[model samples]
Target: MTDPADRGAFIWYELITDDVAAARTFYRNVVGWEIAAEGQPLPTGGTYRMIARSDGGNAGGVLDMSAEMTAAGARPGWIGYVHHSDVDAAVKAVIDAGGAVHMPPMDMPGVGRMAMVADPQGATFYVMAPTPPEGDPDARSDVFDYAKAQHMRWNELWTTDPDAAVSLYRDLFGWTQEGAMPMGPMGDYKFIQHGGDGIGAIAKAQPGGEGSRWQYFAGVDDIDRACRAVTDSGGTLLGEPQQIPGGEYSAYAHDPSGATIGLVGPRKET
Candidate 1:
């Protein structure tokens, strides 16, 4: 059985891309992550590269999408993995709530059971019942820590139907819709809370945007330098870094593989 305390936590993050080598170089230079030189061989096929922070903690991973996966409509993007007590049960709940399954529940030798599912608005993410390694029975994942640099600091969802999307996530993961900030005509940016902390927000999708999707922000030491690195490393920033409530700056960019990513940090004078 899965622990109740572990439910609804963002335990893992992954970047699925076609050009693994280029992505390795791009993210290494931009986010300062230490990606594994060689990926760990998967039982089914191909490899999965583990990302680590400067402190030697696991941050996330890079998945080299198989031809079959791409042919089935998979695209390059960052997806968050939410921990659930039961992978199978979670998939069912999603289906019952108007969500669609992208991949049925499956187990990997060491990774634990997981499945891919999309929300009613077509935003995709993973639900997993992770398998802790031997001797670490109570291991907790810190991949989504907001206070740690190089870790995922925010999980924003821009959806076509904000009200329905918020309700679906609240039912599935026990997340709460706390307070919100008005965004003029775009609509309110509603904050999401889980485990007693503000994890991210759900906002109405703007016209001409990517429709509906989740965009995670990785914390860095310097926002200006990080934005510069994005362009220098073959990625393009969506816009200038904008200051947020906490006085830090956040910027979004498209990696070389056309995968969207966000960065958050302080602005240092050049």
Candidate 2:
């Protein structure tokens, strides 16, 4: 709804899941979020489950990864939304910047412009500049209230070479590398501010552990409760949750299928 061009995370996120209802329940119970039906079907079929506050405002959506999409090898995860003034130009920029377009620009009968793309390192995400809603964007402060137990607070990309990734995005979307974000052994982090303000991040990938991948941060009010819940829910604690300098705490974990995700919560802000 706001200017995607003025940029800073204009669009937040969307979850891609095989079982929409399961995700709905997990989020509702763990994160304290509520979902309302978009009351519309996607081109492939199934409804768009909208996350919102009790008063109703658009936080994001739960994208049902259907059998067809899964059979085609579509993995379930969150697709990051990037702001774009023109979908075609964005797609072209992706190709020109060494990234691949996983899905070309297309129109949603009701939704605005959208496209799917993968970075040179093979991480997948989406870009969408929403169309004007029939009414207006929700004026609620707690847009993410419905899924209070959200496992992802922020999404960060760990790269082997920050310079290469930075160069690619700087060329692709005109994003600027602000400064270094320190994360213990994770090494110096590069914070990317797109369209002058939209914030995303990139870091040197952890050696000998995992390859280049995008990680999402799940928010929790109580870190201990959240960690315990993860194990109880058939999820694996990838590492112990630790308190970051700012009072915020986080750790790595995997869902039932072993998709890596992060658990994050409010911490001291400098």
Candidate 3:
């Protein structure tokens, strides 16, 4: 909304879930978020769930997995949207850049135009042209800061080829590699920055692990406390808090519906 050419910047977040109500409750408790029905229903006759932060900022949404979507192999997971000035042009660029289109461009009555696509390595996300913008482009003052709780703060990509993944984004979103860190044997964890901010990072696909995909991180108040809440609210914590560079901690989890999400927070002192 603020800048149309802000390519490669994550503009919106959406979770396509098998159980919208369960997701609504689980996330509301785990992240202190409040979700409600989108005032208007989609052209398909179903409504989209709006995720709202306590501060009145929008984190993203939860779309009900229609029977058709499930039958067609659309599973439960979160998908991030990239800001693009032209939806059709974005899809074309994705194709020319070696990505595949999962869904063709479709116009939402009120939202804007968008299409779903996967990188050459098969990591999927939306390429969207929101006629009027979606969420707070400046959702966080500093995405590198992990203390901005209850908002969609960061995105991470797991790909088979990190360089190619970074290249595709460079072509699609004008993204640049800010820097990278050695992940020991898994290769470099390459950071992706767009429009002068660190939006997310890319890393090699883990061995015998989940396939290539984009995982979004929502910032919360405390790592220990959120871990407890995640389980208490019917979600599964992936493991213990992972300390990132600069003293911040992050972790991953599986929501009740099996969507993998990430968490960024300050570590609780013992």
Candidate 4:
């Protein structure tokens, strides 16, 4: 269960893709996650695979996009789930704040209620009121831990309207805007803090870049090795890994299913 004090923190992530088998293989090789062979049955008649870290804690989930979902305009992509106390109220707040609801609030038996919403700029993510497991009310999710490998270390939002997107999220999640780093003509990379931890940054999207979207980075043990695995596993690296401010490295890529993914880690020379 998510702590009440951590309402706005990203507690979960999901990859909605058409090719689950390929995505499973790709991420397993690239991020070293131990994806389950079989998953728990979903109420909607499909299995939802849970991603597990090396410590046996859940990292996130993978949902196989059904034909109906595809025809209804669903695409292969990753979406982060923010913890909310009231998903229905959150949905209303999003709509009232000029955002739109992609998926109306719905309950999944033991999973609690959730809704998919987009920022005013059309960057989509989920807001969930998660139901704690039996006898585990204090269980906190560590899927977004920065120092843990195979966990999400960063959540980068590149939007057509960075200010509006930032404002909408801030209003909805209680996140505060913090210091920023200048990114030349692209604009400032403004950091976002949730519960006093740097969760991610908001940046203006480059011209011709994929429109407003969130790109999550999972921590890897070796940036160089992960880059090699991406290409070796039928994925495409956007560019060479680049060093970041903290003496670490980051890289972006598209998986075999064309879902954008990011990786951050130490640059290990082979």
Top model number, lDDT = 1
- How many pairs of residues collide in each model? 0, 23, 0, 0
lDDT (Cα, 0-100) at 235 in candidate 4: 94
- Give TM per candidate: 0.96, 0.81, 0.91, 0.96
Q: Tens-digit lDDT track for model 1 on 132-238?
A: 97778888999998766799999999999999988988988999999999999999999999977999999998889898889999999898888888989888999
The lDDT per prediction is: 0.90, 0.65, 0.80, 0.88
Q: Which candidate model has the greater TM-score, 3 or 4?
A: 4
Candidate 1 at 29: error in angstroms? 1.7
Better of 3 and 4 by lDDT: 4
lDDT, candidate 2, 62-94, per-residue tens: 777767888898776766676666777778877
TM-score of the candidate numbered 3? 0.91
Clashing residue pairs in candidate 4 are none
The per-residue C-alpha lDDT of model 1 at residue 141 equals 91
lDDT digits (tens) for residues 102-221 of candidate 4:
889998777888999988788899999888888888877789987768999999999998888888888889998999999889999999999889999999988888988899999999
**Regions of model 4 farther than 4 Å from truth:** none
Candidate 3 Cα misplacement greater than 4 A, ranges: 2-4, 37-40, 133-147
Q: lDDT rank, highest first?
A: 1, 4, 3, 2
What does candidate 3's lDDT look like per residue over 137-160, in tens digits? 533322223248887778899999
